[model samples]
Target: MFEQFFPNGMLHYLAGGLLIGAGVSFIFLMTGLVSGTSTFFSSAWSYFSTLPFFRQKSFLESRQWRLAFALGLALGGFAFLLTLGNGQAASTGVQWWRLLAGGALAGFGARMAGGCTSGHGICGLSSLQLPSLAAVITFLTTAIITAHAVQLAGVLP
Candidate 1:
């Protein structure tokens, strides 16, 4: 009964969600910050480091935690992929150029929209902010359209 209910790794997703919620709540309680990953990364980007967009004094001040969280996230994903052993299974098998283009588009979209999906979708939506709702809706709609378009173009397997 329990296995069926949690079959095909449902429990892992629940655990991941619990971990994300706890981490966000902890960061908010400790720093009074919104725990936005895109914001943190923007604060540390080498090219953007000298740019005004990322040079706010307060953003520079809390560099320690932001770097820690960013590195931790990257490390965690790498470790998880190693543990999974079949990480290639997650690939869409699209050409590398197409993947790079998609990533660039996503980055541009995130910047233009003020924040990335996790910022708006997870944190903002959880706080019941209308802006977050709008961002999430837009993100999902674009994602759906993109996916279908790629499939229709015979680019997706």
Candidate 2:
């Protein structure tokens, strides 16, 4: 049954999920902070922007560890490329403009919702937050609708 949906195997997905859950749990346990990537961008902007919003105490106080977290995410991907990825670059076959637009929309949505999927879906949901539950439902519904729409449009590359 699993093979029918995941032709490439499901072990990697399971392993990645486990690692993410464990990493988030460890960060929370040690610092009482929810490790969410969406806020990392704002925290990073604190380094260059002197705007009051960017200079918030929360952003400044958490920027250092967030930088390390971002670095770890980058290094992890690089390590994967060097190892399991066979060092070959992969392509999604989508146009760059489309990707950019999609990313911008996602970022905007994340900000409006007060967090990204990782923030709400993983950390918030684990803590039994009501907002996270609603956000997750919305996120999943939007994703499903968008995916179906895209497929129906036959614009796949």
Score every model by TM-score: 0.76, 0.89
lDDT of 2: 0.88
Instruction: Encode model 1's per-residue lDDT on 1-157: one tens digit a residue.
Output: 5777665867678888998889788888987878777766566763356777677776677666778888878887787787864564345566898778987887777867877877898899989999989999888998899889988988754
Give candidate 1's TM-score.
0.76
* Residue 114 shift from truth in candidate 2, angstroms: 1.5
- Angstrom error at residue 135, model 1: 0.3
lDDT of 2 by residue, 43-141 (tens): 889999989998999999999998998898889889888998999876688878769988998987997797888989898999899999999999999
Worst 10 residues of 2 by lDDT: 89-98
True-structure Cα RMSD, model 2: 1.8
In order, the Cα lDDT scores of the candidates are: 0.78, 0.88
Among all windows of 10 consecutive residues in model 1, the one with the lowest summed lDDT is 85-94
